[model samples]
Target: MREARPLPQYLVQRYHGWRATAFVENRVWYRRLADDGQHPRAMVIACCDSRVHVTSIFGADTGEFFIHRNIANLVPPYAPDGEQHGTSAAVEYAVNTLKVAHIVVVGHTNCGGVQGCHAMCSGHAPELEEKSSFVGRWMDILRPGYERVTPLPPEQQIRELERQAVLISLENLMTFPFVKMAVESGNLSLHGVLHDIAEGMLEQYDHQAGGFAPIV
Candidate 1:
């Protein structure tokens, strides 16, 4: 096996500083969490964008949320084929093993993944259409979302597609039999959220209203 390179000095220093402060401030809580396995009540599926800070937005504590990050925060339709599926694996563990009470699919404004999907679908990004592109394949999950938002003007398409990403994920999550059963039996609930990075605002999809409403 090849030896791994050491972390950069700056990152090492920052980690040490954070570790000291975190342990000093919440020693007991951290210890208890280590002793007892995590029992998070919610599973947050969020985009892999650095600007989208799920824990910070919710002020969540350690062991509070079981988080899964992927391109566009997409949850593809439930596929039971004997294939390697990272997102499905996470969903299964969170829903069946962890038994989370809630699942939140969080998308954000100016998402690169969503934009890439839009570009690919619109025949603007030919490079992403290749079979060898992992990103292209991953972004395919948002293709359906892009199609739904195509009717709007080009200027308004991106934001709408971003919101659609969350909605698509929420809808796809229910395709899992366990998720459907849980929701029907009142054991689980699903939510879709869109975060605006520039405005620091959140919009939640209202199933009853059939639209995204800003969080006041």
Candidate 2:
């Protein structure tokens, strides 16, 4: 096994800076959170892309949101085969234990995972098509999404595929028994959103309209 090393100097300096400022200023709140435990009202499943900051976008406090990040913000269909499933585990915990009122899947523009899925589905990414490739397998969850946008132009397909990631995850979330129960009983709500990094725009899926609309 590879030995772990200490944090890089830059990260250490940033940690120290945060500890001195944010941590010190909110010491009491932090302590309260430690003692009381987190009671986040929403669980946000967002892309692991560094630019998509879920907390910053919502202006959320430290314990205000329970967040999970994965490539392309994809959530696979409900599979209970006794295998290791990180995204499913997080969803189960959030719904059953945390009892969060909201579950939001946040997809973003220019997602590498989405682009990879497009390439793989188009037979251009042989490396990702290999069985040994984890990302390739993970992206297989979005294959249906790719099929939905096949008639579009290549560039448009990529853009639509990004939104489809959010829609697919939202649909997959309903496959989870607990999530479905909560939504049926009006205890939990599901939301899908797309964030355009460069344009600084956010569009939310509209169930009635059957497409996404700006939050305005």
Candidate 3:
């Protein structure tokens, strides 16, 4: 095992990370003290990949948004069952508990899960026999997005697929009871966003236009 080293040189001016209380400091502790009482204005459902951090991308100030992360940021269609449904539960909580005014599903370019799903859609993978593996199943969420973007060229297809996945996840969000209720009551709004890490660009879904437009 690696030995515990002293704090890195970057800690010079900074006494400690947790010691300085940002808006999010001790939030989990607050949650422990029955302070989990829903107050965030937005809920972001995003990918677990390091590159897809919505907090950093959106400049979220911690308590401003509730967040849920998953393998690919895809929300599966509603199905009442005993399956592991943490993402769905978080959505429920944000709508039912936090009563967040907005819900955003963020997807990014060059996502490994998206690439793997694209490969699977192209029928080029050699491991179809054991399709129950983690990535294989995770990519299943992208199946429909893959089909929709098939006609575009390779590069364009990827861009379109990423956009479509965000839309699909947004649609999936509406399938939940709490989300639907919030939408119907005009208390919640849904959005889909695409993050271009390479270009440092963020695009918001223009549902009427049916395409992503730069946020700025």
Query: What's the true lDDT of residue 18 in model 1?
Result: 83
Q: How close is candidate 3 to the true structure, as a TM-score?
A: 0.82
Q: Candidates' TM-scores?
A: 0.97, 0.98, 0.82
> Number of the top candidate by lDDT?
2
lDDT-wise, the better of 1 and 2 is 2
Worst 10 residues of 2 by lDDT: 1-10
How many residue pairs clash per model?
0, 0, 0
Task: Evaluate residue 184 in candidate 3 and report its C-alpha lDDT on the 0 to 100 scale.
Answer: 90
For model 3, the superposed segments whose C-alpha errors exceed 4 Å read 1-17, 20-38
Per-residue lDDT of 101 in model 2: 98
Off by over 4 Å in 1: none
| Backbone clash tally (model 3) | 0
lDDT of 2 by residue, 33-110 (tens): 999999999999999999999899999999999999999999999999999999999999999999999999999999
Which scores better on TM-score, 2 or 3? 2
What order do you get sorting by lDDT, best first? Answer: 2, 1, 3
